[model samples]
Target: MARFSEKKIVAGSLITLGVLFSIIAAFTDCSAGGADNYAHYNIARWAFHYPNLFLDHWGKPLFTILIAPFTQIGFFGARLFNILAGLTTAWICYLLASGWKLSKAWLAPVFVIFVPIYFILMFSGMTEILFSLVLMLAIFLFFYDRFVLSAVVISFIFLARSEGAIFLPIFLTALLFKRKYVAVPFLLTGFLLFSLIGQLYYYHNFWWLITKLPYVGGIGANYGRGSWYHFLEKAPDYIGILIFLFLILGMFVWLKKWFSSGLKLRSEIFTRLLIVAGCFWGYLAAHSYIWWVGEMSLGLTRVMAGVTPVAGLIALVGWSEMDKTIKSKIGKAIFLGLTILFIVLPGVLKYKSEFKADTREVVMDEVVKWLRESRNFDHRFVAHDPYFAFSSKVDAWDSRRIQYGFADFTKPELNIADSTLLIWDAHFSQNEGHIPQKEILDNPKFELVAYFEPKVPLKVLGGHDYCVLVFRKMENLNVDNNQLMIKLKDEQLKGNLVYSEFFDFEHAEPGKVPDQFVVQESDTFSNKCYVLGKDSEFSPSVLLTDSQLKISNEVSVGVEFDFLAEDQLGNNEVLMVFSVEKEDKPYFYQGQDVLAVDSAKWNHARYHFYMPEEVKKDTKVKLYIWDIQKKNLKIDNFRVQAYSK
Candidate 1:
């Protein structure tokens, strides 16, 4: 009894910590942006705009209701829901830990630290965390013999994430030990209620149901029966090194009892493992049956998230079966390793990365300032970073799309090209295939004006991208006195034929280097602007001459250029930039580091340049280089001054 009390204390602490950490992390930028994060944002936006429609479209009234309050606050609110769900999950895990009589010291932190997926999903602002929480609640209710509540919880769990349906039966099988026939009613009731809700919401939209059926099948195939070899390959990544080893030790301790014992949890354990194994098998089968390796990989990770608690619980129970001496030795080894990898490594790396990346508030401030100053308030923008779309009042969409058809299916007049802002993530571009930036930038209607590059290169830790770029339209069009002319000289070009390595200023032969003109990979980083011209034969220069002149008559010229020098050790040195002026008189204005050699996106060094407005009179302007030493800069274009009207 004392042991149970102490265990409860530890479980409660774990729950508390999970809630606290989630709240604190909410204030940090780690929870803001990602690809899957965009999906949730889409759902939330739908919820906010058309509540009834969202309920109908998603086939999950409970899940939609769960996020409605947060959806009112926009993306951040939805993120709060995830954090709360994560907390609920933590509490559920804590309860399991208490039931298993594990030390709180051993269990509390493991809710997040031991599993990379937990932290990643929690920080990424996706549905996985919420789904995990729901799954746990249903499992806990089922185990406690609360059949009706379990049915409702499981119904909602499926509503939250479709895979719940596949795993529900396996969970019900656990009850077969007490009353073999009792499982049927719970299964049928749960399925009927859930399906009835979905069907009613859709009004029996067979097409939609048919379309979604494949996803369920796909999930099962990926986790269930692809291949044992593939499982072995991905197991280490999904479970992590320390957790996998602990599971191995646990397997040894629980081997005999897991299969033959008549302990209180014997049937429950077998059923739980069967369900988990089924999920694993389903995922594998889906992968083997699919063509897109990328899509399979993504789905597999999500499936793994839903099953993490089961893995953790099983490993704990198994470890509990071991002798004190054996358990202590195993625990000590696992603890030491986990401390080094989960605690020390992640802490150090996150600190360094945070320092390297610009603060979220800083970037938000810049974005808002740019929008206000440019009067781009009502324009519909597509940002590579989903957070902007979620946070800003602008009509923003996710530019991280696999299919690139810009023509509006809803409105014939609208096209992808009509999007006013194409905010690109530099780091995402680097991982993607070559981007036809020149063609996009050279479009007569589309002009690249503003760009945001990071101060440091973004490194991929665990298959995630974290960098950004912002591009706005030009204000002028007529090649008035406010434009600048640039000549791409042969001597100024340097690079292999495959890709334009901007540093050397020398052109390579055709077909030798990778083309930077088009994006090959759907998820890779890329320039937001369109690329123009196929070869380096010096095509027509892009023009940006608008008549909204309020500044000095001096032509406000901006140019995108690249540099290739090596030893850049200096306090402040000129890196060569382009701008415009009417008279020799100076003017006051603002400028930014549009491109940097440090971008993870650039195949070589590059830079982008833009002028907010034509130079104004009495503007005391002095150019200052932000830093030096990065080579291979690519100058997109330079905007020059327009003659004052």
Candidate 2:
């Protein structure tokens, strides 16, 4: 009892230290990567408003719930949660160490402190630390014969990260060494009930535990079939050659003793060793991080967070059997040396960064301000680093845009013209294919209005400096093109008659329309306008000839038609006839006009002709369309109507 009490105190101290450091780190400027922290913020908002949809991402609701209150208070709160969770994870590691009867309980805290990647992840608002804590607690409870507590803790671990389910079979296999018959039923019942009730009913995963097996299995298959370099890289760094050496030597000693002992004691030793070894091997093969860079401090921290418990268990078994020889003391020295090596390296690295004090950073303050000022309920901006904007109350793209790694601006769905401002980093573009500067400038429909080089470059994936680019729709700008025209004709008019020729409306063609206007030249073809009127002599011509103001010397004759760009039904010329004479008499008149479309049907139009209230035999009229721009007169569809007085 005295020994147990001492162990608990030591373990508890280690846990407290780790948690305290995590809190301090969180309060510091510890936001590392972009995407994961962004995901935390997004999920927090999602869960706050629609908690029922939590199943869409398995069991991230716990994380969401934890983040909700912090997020409400701003970034400081979220940062604090990250720190607390990281410390809690270290505490769980200490608990596992105590359970395994490891002598140096401080190893867990050292591992957390020295691991650089772990430090980055600690304050990044990611799930790694939270998941690690739950895993440690579940395993500790399982070994303590608290099956119900173990099962609940395991369920929550799985909830934290879908990959946590892989540990279930490993836990069951470990139990085989502890209690043979009990292992089978306990594992089966725990899993079946968890799946049936927690996953299927409460979590809404109908398939339960069985559904989770494939994902775990796939992780194992990937490592077994993947590169040997991957194994070598992650293996030695976290599993430290010294610790494994101890594990192996301890295992041999236990096995030899088991062979010499009587049946019952032998059974107990074998079961304990089997559980410890099986879990170690199974996790190595199945955990997703197996292929990650184990050499990095962060990677080592993650591995040790879980692996230390197994090492501690094996060390305990060896301690029970040792004779306290000089060699045993040397081994202890080696283990302590390894712990110091990991912890000191990271602590030193942090100090080194402090010495440099030249970290480049983005000033997201202006960016966030713009988003809040510019955003509406309906408008969403496509910023490359949307996470920062999202954290600031600005609406951003959906999951489709977030697919893969960064933002893809070229997606056609992003073209809606309701003030679409593309904020991009120039360096980001360079990495993305060096999108041509001319491509944006030459766009007829988009005009670049603003560019800003952030005081500090944004830390984006693919390692590029980032900036903001703004563009506006080109709708309000008038296009100066006397480069467009139209013609109409019909051979059923007579006398001093002239026709007003004009096509009405202006804009792009809506939907699809039959090619009605034939252009005379190839140079006139454009995606904006379909050519229908050609320059064929007999094709269609606008003509004007008239003498209305008592032989006021026949002025030049001309004609013009409105460009049909309105709705397909509303896009036709209205033929209007009016005299250019000083007197309100007819100078010339063309009868009702007809469209000379390829198909002999009058598609759509309204007509106005100037005939006297009572036609005098001598009433004269001139015909022309009112000059728009240059006031060019036009005549076509030759015909004259004579009403005798």
Candidate 3:
């Protein structure tokens, strides 16, 4: 009776946890996979209206079709679709664990739910969550002797993600070993079905599948490559160390089992080892090679989310092996408690660290609001960013409001309508769309109307300020491209000292950086401040210590400092950089050059910078003055004051 009661309690607990996660995820603006999430969601959101987008290659037709109905209601509805798939995947993991005769089968859901990257991707519109559910279901069916069904289901894998093509040969080899020739034909179901449906676009071209491939290009020269251990190193970051340790243990167990029988492919073992474990290792190896060779795609850790379900199984195997050793029931309970804590803690910490909404989204929202209020706000726009379209409520199907075009801006003479706004961003427009900024800058047909840049910058690697340049196609240019920046301000700037300090080194510790810097020095102060002499080994720099930099795009910060190049170099001026970095990623940058007016003289220079916004979202704001040019320079009585406009 106690065992039955425990089973009911466990089932009810899973249901409750799943519902809670769903509700929380719906409201959260956490990104699934950056720009790709919005790109995929936009396709799914509008595919119902156009119908042609159901066959869009870049959008991943299967993913678009699967989530389209939910997306029709809203992006939240689309999130719920992925969330439902996630919860169902957890249930499948539970079933797979129970079927494998694992002692702690109930821990399967817990393991799947807590995978750090997996948890994040499950709330997004990306194809990974559903792909995970589909692939895992295929594994379960294959193991249960539903050979034809498994093949039919696995056939749709490629439509979910381009990586699915890599699995076809391995799957075919497994089918051949098991002598399931009947199911072999069914493996092409997804390709054949989609191909037949895509005939309308292809104009009866049977070779449309090969011709319309989305990711068919060669290696990108600048996308960067990684070693084989790239994913291995980043594994702990995405899956957390607890799952990573167990994953290594699980792989060891599987490899041991595979080699114990001298590479034998027994029918019973083939399903689990050849297919299940094969998918796990196969997916990992392919990605490792793809990144290692610097090919088709860059090494994005989020791609691993697609195979997280299988990794969860391997993790479960590792946990099961460890669970077997604890003889005491009390010890086992304690172990279970710790496992949950370790798995969940990383995700919770990550959630707390990241902003509720990404800087890109925040800035894009502001840009859209600004655009709506501007002159000719209703004029047609040409933009590459999917988020901009979503924010502007521009129907991609209707090219009147906005044209989803690119590469057109590369031309010197654009044929766009007069007053049409070409909204270009530093991201998609520059990278994927190949819209060269220099061409637009040189083009006379385009007029720089409004420029939008974020205050708080994106903290991701290879991130940019997400500058949205609003240019109007004009016969006669109104504004100079060189002076596109127009600062908006009231008559009086708001006096708000987010932080202020003055350091003259009057009471300074010798050979140490200054602190607080509040001691104001009167005239006739000592000349004992920090200095960097000619050919000095170390650069004496001013670092704003423990300052909560909450400056925004509208905030104006005045920087003042006393400097002297006692023995000034031959035309080598000190380039002082007042940089603000978050997590070593320098996003907000404002700098100045201190050219010595006269040699051996202390020159006082003052400058004000309009800082970007919400820098407080970072772990730490490093506002420091550095001698980037490394010229012989002296600095003292440095002061920084911030005010809002």
Candidate 4:
């Protein structure tokens, strides 16, 4: 009875703390909407009116569905949902810790609340808090032997973020290891039922989700790819280095205890620990392949938020074990002081930094006000940031969809007619090849209408300067004549020309592979290049051998290619290659900078490659236009030249 009362007290305290924090979050206007937040808000707003609108594979449908009702109340309601989810997560963490009989079980809830990322996300209106809540609840239910309930919750976790599916295998394996054969079937059934529902409601087949797995895995690849050790490097920023060390130590200690016990300790607590450790390590391993994991600006820490509560619990376990093992009271006290300093100090500092008033709010409000005053309700707007669109209650399209190939801006099917407005900001421009600012600027269709800037200097963390430019499409503008174009004049070429090939396709067959070139197989495209706008995939590469081009000692070599592309959906890249073979071994090198060309026009692209004196004599070169996407393009002139001082 005493233990039951103690558990009840702990639960009550956690609930109270969570509610208090949430109320504080509600009153505080310190929240900032990120790209993900804007996407979530837009999806939620769309869900309020149209049930079948969210058919895209990229949308996290479950989040939008859950938050749709609250979105009518605007950002506050959306943030309130997150706040409640965060508080519930804290309560769930305490329950799990108490069930496991961990020392200082109440501390688990405090840990969840104190984590800076969790605190910040609770107010920012992102899915992390809600996702973490469902995830932890699933774990807690599983430990309590509620297999079917756990399975149902697990399905919701999967819907929250597709990555949550990674936990499914681990959960099933734990059940199998424990000889719970019936539970496995129940879990599988629940998973399939949820997946089928998603397919029906989203109007997509199973393969739609399956095919997007690779795309999700490769997200942010163009920005940068991170090494496997990215998590290790960023650990200090997310959680202090000292606390991270304790977490690692706890894992080692847990392993030693399990192995020494002959691996037969199948207690519920031990199983729970195994599951948590599996999830913590599993998320790190899976995210290592993602390009955004390496880019701190892309929210690498936020990606790890789901597993942070488990880590904190594990670290506390390690700290308790170490405290008990210490022989000297002075030493134990010193260790405790240092641990407190590491864990609490950093979080307090981070909390202060995060809770500051987000200055972007002012700029966003101003832009929305201007739109409401200047534009009619029927006017369509295009913007990278959806917050302005949602706030102003105007029909808007996200430019990112076009940049990422999810939608084509050039296609008339999108309804971007004359009088449409285009808004661009620096934050969205950082993603290379995705920013269509230049295209919008170059086209005479869009004329600059207004530029909005923050009246006061904003110092929000990870905040960029406010430069929101709005452009309105001109009436009766012909998109064909004003299509995006790239031009390189003859004067831009550097050094003396040695050889040039003007490819007029005179000797080459019209539909067949060109002479001196061979087709390379690609999953996205079949042929490298043919007649422009043909059905052939344009990303194919053709190799050239040493017989085609002889290399001489030259300080620099330059190559220029003339190409035409039509109806380009995404970023198109062309590559220039150089190679050498030594002692039957081949060495190949390519130019560093890829020439990016605009769609629906012809381009004269130039690139230079410098050859060292040592390798120039035996070097053999190969040149091919490497199309990054499988868009239709035409090649006319292929020119190569050598240059010396």
RMSD of each: 13.8, 24.7, 7.0, 15.9
lDDT of 3 by residue, 94-113 (tens): 88888888778888887787
**Global lDDT of each candidate:** 0.46, 0.45, 0.71, 0.60
Q: Residue 171 error for model 4, in Å?
A: 1.4
For all candidates, the clash counts are 98, 36, 5, 0
Candidate order by decreasing TM-score:
3, 4, 1, 2
For every model shown, what is its TM-score relative to the native structure?
Answer: 0.58, 0.52, 0.81, 0.64
- What's model 4's TM-score? 0.64
Candidate 2 CA-lDDT value: 0.45
| Candidate topping TM-score | 3
What's the true lDDT of residue 352 in model 2?
A: 36
- In candidate 2 the C-alpha lDDT for residue 28 amounts to 62
Candidate 4 minimal-lDDT segment of 10 residues:
482-491
Tens digits of lDDT, candidate 1, 428-451? 322331223333344344444454
Number of the candidate with higher TM-score, 2 or 3: 3
Question: Per-residue alpha-carbon lDDT of model 2 for 526-589, expressed as tens digits?
Answer: 2233222222112132233233222222222233333331212111232334453335544444
Clashes of 3: 5
Question: What does candidate 1 score on TM?
Answer: 0.58
